[model samples]
Target chain A: MDKSIPSLAQAVADIPDGASVMIGGFGGSGAPIELIHALIDAGPRNLTVINNNAGNGHVGLAALIAAGQVAKLICSFPRSADPRVFNAKYLAGEIDLELVPQGTLAERIRAGGAGTPAFYTPTSFGTDLARGKPVAEFEGRSYVQERWLKADFALIKAEAGDVMGNLTYRMAARNFNPIMAMAARTTIAQVSRIAPLGSLDPETVVTPGIFVNRVVLAENPAQEEVLNRQEAVYP
Target chain B: MTNPAMIDLEAVKLTNAQMAWRAAQDIEDGAYVNLGIGLPELVAKFQPDGREAIFHTENGVLGFGPAPAKGAEDWDLINAGKKAVTLKPGAAFFHHADSFAMVRGGHLNVAILGAYEVAENGDLANWSTGAGGVPAVGGAMDLVHGARRVAVITDHVTKSGAPKLLTRCTLPLTGVGCVTRIYSSLAVIDIAQGRFVLREKVAGLSVEQLQSLTGAKLHIEAPVTDLTAAQVA
Candidate 1:
């Protein structure tokens, strides 16, 4: 457990281009704005990123996607409304996209943390999502063995962190940070406040310090909400 | 004899179990609910079936629904124990890290549960007590603690003829003072002042008969009759 905290940009600038990254947030909430902004400033192009949903229009993960640094986006839903720009320019042929069912995406990341090579889940069994995936039957039911999903770096957002790196996520912003921390080789967190170790309730800490490699502090921005629209524009 | 106990039992169409589900219909829309396995799953079958309230699974679901089609049952799309499922519009998938967040964070409005034993003090021990061994305490720990309101549905008596709603739960605790309201075959009870506040009584059973079968005192609410089946929404 490192006791030092650095600026968000300094922590993320070391990550090279083409790295496997996982950002934590659901919809447009709880995104690590400081690290994302830092990554954009550093301009490490051609990277692969994973998250539950794409950032919503420059507020969440939307910042990185907007900066043209993301080479390929592997996600279930990209509701940020900027995928059109990504598709026309960066993803036209240069970048790639792998769209997956939400269940499969979570299981893959969970498998990474559980140390399971692969486990069969009935989630995408009969759908085209099972194409080329390992198949098996258990207890009179069939499932696909979705492979483990891990990354080189998992950038997470937390409401607060202690010197020991124990974390507490605030509300819906709590999305994928804890599991992503376990699945990544190096986990960095941006927290609004840094407290002494043992300050937070053990019952409330979502992601523990053991999985975290670095702690960065920045005044995280307020959460942005996605307004409901009649027609979704994504292809 | 004076009032002439309704000899006509013909209008009742619900099975013994469906009667229980009709009792569950009182759960308002937009409520956060947890449906236990078995007869309780049927509650979903009866809920005003549209996008009204959120259905949560201890295995990790916040916005997941649209029950599976008969043929396209994907075992993976299932709930906590891996049961097949369907997805509804406006449903979004999350890494359970966030789903449980909603639960533990007190974001849930209600949780409908199935129980084996509900104590007078609202203690519950529904997970285990099978013939083979102690039950596997899976996600029950999380769901019990996380859910804001826990309403249980179960039989009034155990298979061996002992009261299921006892003066105090005999099995290990799930959550301390966790339950809010209880719906059983013989009656519906709300925990009031560390005791069972009987809200409704079965048609055939009297207050004394219901009380003698229990380990706790019963507070009876007036006009106790069985619930009626609602048109499926």
Candidate 2:
């Protein structure tokens, strides 16, 4: 089935307020900036965003947060290169945060996509992050149990995509995009180029079409770090 | 009592670059290693000649090379520290799940990290100070326990001259009984049998002088070698 969409705004128009979204990126590498901006323009409220970092300067995710679209942030690092936006909101008690270790966060999203309910890991076993969680010992080693994290929607970026929604990402940009695509109810992808259906090599497709619901073209998308450097703020 | 004047000279303490260089010498060839953000990132610059270590950044890239020249950076290619990077010839990219799986699944050879404090019993505290601010714990907790061998590189004492190698960590921990070795500013020590085993100290520094700077008792096991590094131009 063809999953290609015409416009960024239309692709994100259906996302409602209070939705839990998993935005793909590790500090802007694979962040779906256009899709995020589209969602911001669509004007959703009370969103709980899942990302590696909360946001950098006043551009992408920070702009979304500044727009008052996010109510909570679920991430590993809230303090980014420039975390002024998140810091202000958090210190003022205007937003909530659920901090998870980076590996555990990735595993939780993987488990959610794979239909696993819960799993045990040795990470954060005796720290404040593991407090209030059930702990069990296996073979003389203790591990804390973490639950799966599924989202209402996932916004992701890709290097190349087909109308069938098969996606491939470039270099380090592949960080969370592929897994976030599977962990959400609906996955919206912004690709730099839309290749023909048969053009993508089957063996190299990082995310198959089955997990993707919508694909939009975002050729020459703005880089978050560059935008932050230019001190560009969104409306 | 520690003699401050006797230990304050550059000849007695290893510089940050020397400490990183000293730590990099121990990495075996063909090992998969993860270097933590700040001080640990310097380790990549001094990999021993004829030995190649594949660098793993938690962000997704494996086999990443040094930073690209000015204006040659691709924003999409960066390290776990979110700094611009370039890929080596044989580099591979995967999703975050697989990247962290390489970390949490014990597929990495060594993980070098910066420490705020390390207990004699091998406990590590580097993530937070429990201060009144936003607490951010990145992939540190996982790297400490997951890598096959965990080593820390840091100044032996705090900037205010307080001992960082302690009998017990006063701050929150990243992992319990996880660290195995430390390359500090003044010495190379190993954490074994719940004691600080002195392996090496900087040239011209006496055992008593080094001991005076440490929080815990330094047990003399083998003859301490001079902690030295090849001078980098």
Candidate 3:
């Protein structure tokens, strides 16, 4: 019953070159920076990374992209605050991008986790984005068929976790983390703090322990401090 | 949204806030609105009194207030754009799926968005130009297609002076035939029956001048009237 926390290196050591990974976050808010930094330092190449934005500034996934670690990026927003690295790589044909609409991205990840292979959504219907995709009409409206988005591993960030891996997220930081956790074969969460099993309330747990395989505490406490101050106002 | 006061309204013809203010007048009272990033976000701040429009951000915050005051930013609280914002009373955070359901399920009454181009036929192309670039399409596709009414706010022309209201969008579209109205720096245009009709224009601008600047034909059904300063204020 013991799924002990591992060192950041051991946590991501299983990730190999060309593995499809889902990294969670809207920007840097809920990003698991320490684990991502470790992954970058571990130096896996040609990886396909899925996330919301490319990355903000020169940190997190951006650092991984800047290191030339990623071969493809499947994201909703590829352009962020400073997207020069991705822009340059994309324009030069050094990397590839598969842009999905945000809502569809979330639902696809959710669908992937829920064992649904595909679903019809009205989003992006009748547009170039819907081009060449399977289309269906229900009640006189068009819908594009989007397949489930699954990955070999999901790297996520959470506010807190119990020893059993029950997790909770802070405010908007919960963005893509929970969905990615469900959508991946192996889910590793980087959390601010770990509590005892009985200390976490069952009703409040956002991601039940079954979905998360490993939990690692953030290397930098200051990052957690910033999030703490941000969430301080809310319960 | 950036401060509208900083913009040279005369040079750009209309400030972003003024454009938002113009759009706000059309939004009815007690409407559930979703404001997209950039200029559309300013619409919430300018929402007139007596109209209690509940704002929704796709990242799962609803009843969100305007941007937090400088130095008072809370990292935990952010809109879908990843910018820090204050939460209004009764504001609630839910799962991303539910937030999007409110959008895709057509629970939202109106969605105000920024656009790259809008064709005369009401096709919206705000996500990307599709010219060799990253082409990040966020929730624009769902918001335009799902919202009951879609309103676009944008510059009349690009920085390079290319008209954005076109005969047909040469760019990748976010949604087809989704735009109901357009509030631009130069004029308030409505898309009806596949034509861009002039509703009102900023002072010192004429329908002929608008036609010269617009790539598509401008249909003037109503008497062209000056957009008074008080109306924008």
Candidate 4:
């Protein structure tokens, strides 16, 4: 129902401090840089951020971490090539880190989005990472039980969207954004362009409007170009 | 005095590209392969001619091509390493759940990865050092368990010259009894019944010399072939 938000500032205004936020990005490919900047300017402290890597360079989530807004980071890879921001903060004990296997992290969020409470997985079944977690055995194989991971808000970036908030993302940029959108209480998508309703092919829609609460047009359509220019970052 | 049995240590180590080329020969046609980051990624570029294997990346692109040439990078098209990639003619992009489901569901025929250590029993430890430092475990855990075959392409030794083929992995394990074969700079080894079987070695490198550098005991297969010199170039 016309869930368009005109400015990034207005979009992130209601996100309170200490919110559990899921950010969408895979090495800056699908990162919502403008929305992240808005979140930084909005100054919400003590945030719990969930993403793939810590951040790439200084543009996306790294800026938020650098600004000291993030209190805890739940991610798969907490170290990047230039992990200066996350590294410095983590070394200083300024932030808490939770490193989940990339697949399990995605599954947990998917479970949350689908309303599944918990699932047992073979991923991390025998490692120290599985320590303290409940283990279940099936067919003589062990699996670690992981609970669903939901967020207070999910800020995502999409290649295209409609006024109704249906989204279509680019190649790898589609990684965590769609799942995070479904798992969050409120999902705000930053898009390069918004088309008229029904203009986008229904089959091409990766995230339907029902999951998206609002859509904010990104300030830079070429924001993702930064991803290619980035040197091979550590995982 | 140098032992007559020990080959010149500095003369015959394979390059990462050569290891990748060797690894590519193991991939069967009509297989679904996942090329892990680093050395394994190079396999995509040197895939065996006349072999057709569909490549999958955990970040949701399948039918991926080799790394894009310089200045041809497309940010939207990237592998797990965050390096720009190209999409093959039949490439498809899906969501994270589906991408990993392809991984965890045993749809992938092979997953070739770089490793910190691979135990003789087929255990792999590549995710972390087990130190108190920040742990970074990506999709290796999922890939190893789900892929039908797991191959590792890594340097033979650590920067300090410690062998990576170990009796037991001292670091946190990514998967136990998961790796099927190992393609290293020095040799191509297979794990069979908890032993490292040497199948191929670099020219001039003797079994005794290789064993001295290896942390695990080795069983040499008959007629160990020397890697062709042209493949190294």
Candidate 5:
């Protein structure tokens, strides 16, 4: 079945307010900038965004937060290189923040995708972050129980994608894209190139077509860091 | 009464680069290591001549080489610190889940991190200072326990000259009894039996002088070696 979408706007148009979204990126590397801007233009509100960093500057995720679309942020690090946008909103009580350790966050997403309800980990056992979590001891060591994190939608970027939505990411840009693709109900991928069917090698497809729902072509996507370096702000 | 030997010993504290170099000497070859941001990152530059430590960045890629030249950087190819990097021949990329699986599954050999405070009992506190501001923990909480061995590299004292190696961490803790070794500017200490076991100290510094600067009692188990590093230009 062909899952290719015509435009970024149409792909993210159905993401309503109060939806939980997993935006793929570690900092700005794998972030789907065009799709995020399209979501902003679509004007969703009260979004709960799960990402690694809050946002760098006033371009991609920062722009979404600046647009007052995000009601809460579920992330590992909310402070970025230029986190003035998120910081201003969070301090003013305009948005809520749920901070998870980076590895735990990744595991939760993986567990959510794999249909595991919860798992025990030693990541945040004795820290402030582990407060109020269920703890269990195994062989004299304590482990905290962390629940799975599933999202209503996932916006991800890929280097190449086929019409069936089989995707391949570039270098370190593959960080959260593949896992977020599996964890979300509807995964929307923006690819730099839309390869022909049977073009992407089966052995090399990081995210298979079964996990992705919509694939859009963004030939020349704007990079968040470069845009921030230019001090570019969205409308 | 000014003791000239004491003054000379005080002036010879290891610089940050030298401390990093000293820490690099301990990493076993063919080991998968994670170097935290800041001072710990410098350990990558001083890997011994024959030994190689495969670097792991939480962002995804492993076996990454040093940073690319000024204009040669690919923003997509970056480290956990979000700085552009180059991939080594054996480098491989994976999703965040698998990257962390290598960490949380104890597949990594060592994790070297910078710290705010380390208790004599092996507790680490590097995430937050508790001074009313945004708190970002990143991957520190996981790395401390995930890696087989956790080590800290930091200045012996704070900028105001307060001891960082303490009997108890006053700030919030990152992990409980996780750190095994510390590579500080003043000394190389190990946490064994809940005590700070002095293994090495700055040359010419007396044991009494080092203990005066430490917050906790420094235990002398055996003959302490002089902490020295070959000068790197």
Candidate 6:
């Protein structure tokens, strides 16, 4: 109804260098590939990408990585799928990295949305995890709660959306999109399909419209890039 | 149905006090385990010595150790509830994406969790009771489907004197038939023949009472007797 946030390129064109962002997905399952491509084309430099996985060599977020736009990466690097072939440019002293454990990564984002600055946890104690962190105890045991994390923008992928930005994800695709929607100051959604307002069942919307700041309808259904091979080849 | 073999009836029953030791025995050396929030969280204290299984905290630390001391708290290394925890040697830190991958990737061997309701068919619904006040399932979805073994630890009955075990759970489901074993205050039940087969029970409770409390048919194992920690372990 409100003229769909202009355009994808226009939306991301203003993002400054060194901007912090949270890109939602589980191993490239739910990333906003179209918007990511737009950023790649628009050529924003020194961008810090926070995502589950760097998309495989050719598509998804890898477009930016390949285009040499991402200057730093703050995410849970894929132990299973690395963007080595695509990311070699950055890994060779071209970019910065801050790797967070998967669980702690989610909590930091969630805690940021919950309005908490920081909390303690017991995940990292004696090993290299505690090497640089401050430590303490509870009930004779130790704990370390990480600080909350927030981003200037959060780019997410959803299965369907409405004019109000009420969104839903298909099956496992829901992954981290819903949470990333809440953890950023400006959350943008790239969806496969768009529906009229009130067309979607209220109960089924996983992400409420309030959290979404912009929405883009991806046109390249044929080239809907993702990390997993099955997703790339399907349809 | 009952097993009429000659045996000590006491050995079939499990008391509340023996739960920790019995649960500890389930842990083998070098198994990667996740201790769920609530009662299941207590399992960390009961782990057997000389066994060095890695513990993962959903908050992001793998190779998790015991809780920490006062004035030495690290705000960034906490559990799902923002609680503090200790890290074991060689423990690694990463974002939740990788932590869940480890879980969903079949890297974790066992997950000890608390349950609100368990069905005869192994349907687990521990997330949202849709109650007036309580936290809903936040990470239970990933935990249940990812772990190799899902062990439920809880009391047999509700505080209102009702049973948490039901004929079919009316609460939101966590997974269908995902539960491998159930450890309760009065009994430990295992999945048998598509329903619960009583592995052991607590002292002084009757079979009829157990059945009534379960609200479902349960097959009592042979050689009925009270359960010691050894039997459950």
DockQ of model 2 vs. true complex: 0.88
Candidate DockQ scores, in order: 0.05, 0.88, 0.54, 0.71, 0.85, 0.04
CA shift of A213, model 1, Å: 1.0
How accurately is candidate 6 docked according to DockQ?
Answer: 0.04
Residue-wise lDDT of candidate 3 within B118-199, one digit each (tens)?
Answer: 9999998887777655688889998987889999999888876668899998888888889989999989899999999888
lDDT of 1 by residue, B78-99 (tens): 5543355666665554456456
Rank by TM-score (best first)? 2, 5, 4, 3, 1, 6
lDDT of 4 by residue, A84-200 (tens): 888889989999999898889999999999999999988887887788999989999888999999999999999899989999998888999999999999999999888888899
DockQ of 5: 0.85
Collision count of model 3: 0
Model 3 CA lDDT for position A148: 98
Residue pairs clashing in model 2 are: none
When just chain B is superposed on the true chain B, each candidate scores a TM-score of 0.82, 0.96, 0.90, 0.91, 0.95, 0.86
Which digits, one per residue and each the tens of the lDDT, describe model 6 over residues B1-233?
13223223344445443675677678899899988876677677766779877888764567866768965644334565435566777987544545676776668999988888888877777766666331223456557767889888876766554667777787867666677888877777887667788877765667666766665777876755664564332
Compared with the true structure, what per-residue lDDT tens digits does model 4 show for residues B21-70? 88888889989999888778888767677988899988989898877889
Model 2, range A60-150, lDDT digits (tens) per residue? 8999999999999999988887899999999999999999999999999999999998999999998889999999999999999999999
lDDT of 2 by residue, B94-131 (tens): 89889888998999999999999999999999999889
Evaluate all candidate structures by whole-model CA lDDT and list the values in order. Answer: 0.65, 0.92, 0.83, 0.86, 0.92, 0.67
TM-score of every model versus the real structure: 0.53, 0.98, 0.89, 0.94, 0.98, 0.52
**Candidate 1 TM-score for chain A:** 0.88
lDDT of 3: 0.83
Give the worst 10-residue stretch by lDDT in candidate 6 chain A.
A226-235
Runs of candidate 4 exceeding 4 Å displacement = A222-235, B1-7, B220-223
Q: What is model 1's DockQ versus the real complex?
A: 0.05
- Worst ten in a row by lDDT for model 6 chain B: B1-10
CA shift at B117, candidate 6, in angstroms? 37
In Å, residue B226's CA in model 6 sits off its true spot by 27
Q: Could you tell me the lDDT of residue B140 within candidate 2?
A: 99
Q: Candidate 1 DockQ category? A: incorrect
